[model samples]
Target: MPGPLLRPLPILFLTRPEAASARFAEQCGDSGLRFDTVISPLFRIEATGPLPDASAAGGLIFTSANGVAVWLAQGGRRDLPVYTVGDATARAAEAAGMRAHSAGGAADDLIDWLIAHTPDLPLMHLHGRHTRGDVAERLTKAGLTCGSAVIYDQPAQPLSAEARAALLGTTPVIVPVFSPRTGELLAQERAQAPLLVAAMSEAVVNALGPLHKRDLKVAARPESEAMREVVSDLLKRALAGDY
Candidate 1:
């Protein structure tokens, strides 16, 4: 007699804006991680305010691809060297005709990289309204000239009906939270269904508060690849009846 086969758990990527969620979904598909994905963004990325002039900056800092997109849209200069928090942002900057260097991942890592490499450059950080870590402040305190400008805003949005249904459904839901703000938002929703969270860092997990203690898995590094690996492990566990 053959027992029933276990179904793959559904992955619910509650990331910001449509673009980021779509990118994650694409990555999941490309990784051959067999699972249904529901991309319901919980925030909208809107360009707010004008972009600052970067002609005088020795280098530029970007924490998110959203910042790169907004800066490019607002006619930012591409001649200056660009330093990014992760690979994605670095790619975005390069795509926009700028020389970009990736700091591996996380704002703290970016700060460290800047300190070590561009210690004397006048850097300007272009970021969203909601940002983690004080990149500019920390750099300035470290005797490096650093400034920041808000190029975009990620306004909070409610989850879609499909997302809500998926979250509360019988199938296990796997979520990868990239930022503390997004983690906090997911915590507020507090879906009672079975959930496995893949947080980018300890900060993100902390933002989720105490309710998701048991099911939360923090990535080894605060990078998309690390988070994806965590999600892949969770999916494997789910298919093996260990989730």
Candidate 2:
């Protein structure tokens, strides 16, 4: 006789924006994986000001979709050189009329790209106030003149009482952290459960700090799609079990 399907695994999702949760749900699907999300948005996305003038920026950098969306909403020139840290941001930049040049899918990689296939123009990094890595500083330290604007702040949102209880209860939980802030939150809360933590790169995994490694299995890929792709495979396993 076949074994009883395990109850849907209880997974925790970290999200601040409503949109983020919706996508997470779609990603999880109706697999035997029950989702318990904490609306702990390590930051918020908001328009800081008018879209910058490309004539003044010379070139631009974007690492987050919020940066791309806000700039697109404000309408910048479609002809400027746009550099991005990840593929999604590049796609968003393209949607915003920016002819984007990718930086190898990571902040650090982008810096390397700058050093290699370099652009001969003054650069402006359009980003969130809470930048994850040392890209801008690395560029400037390398003697590159890069301007910047804190277009938004990715502030953390605290978990609610219900979410806390659900998380504290039993079940394997997977957290796919796209940013260090999300990983830091998981590290700080160290709930007693098997954690499958995924990030976008080795740096992002390191950025999670000691709290993450204390009691979790961690995996970091190189892109948002890659992170989601890993989680998708887990859901497929769940479906096969008929849980």
The residue-level lDDT of candidate 1 at 109 comes to: 87
lDDT per residue for candidate 2 within 79-117, as digits (tens), equals: 777888877778887876678888756787888898776
Model 1 segments more than 4 A misplaced: 1-9, 211-214
Q: After superposition, how far is residue 116 of candidate 2 from its true place, in Å?
A: 1.1
How well does model 1 score by local distance difference test?
0.81
Output the worst ten-in-a-row residue range by lDDT, candidate 1.
Answer: 6-15
Full-model lDDT, candidate 2: 0.65
TM per candidate comes to 0.92, 0.79
Model 1 lDDT, residue 81, Cα: 87
Backbone clash pairs for candidate 2 read 41-156, 42-155, 42-156, 43-154, 43-155, 44-154, 44-155, 200-221
Instruction: Count clashing residue pairs in model 1.
Output: 0
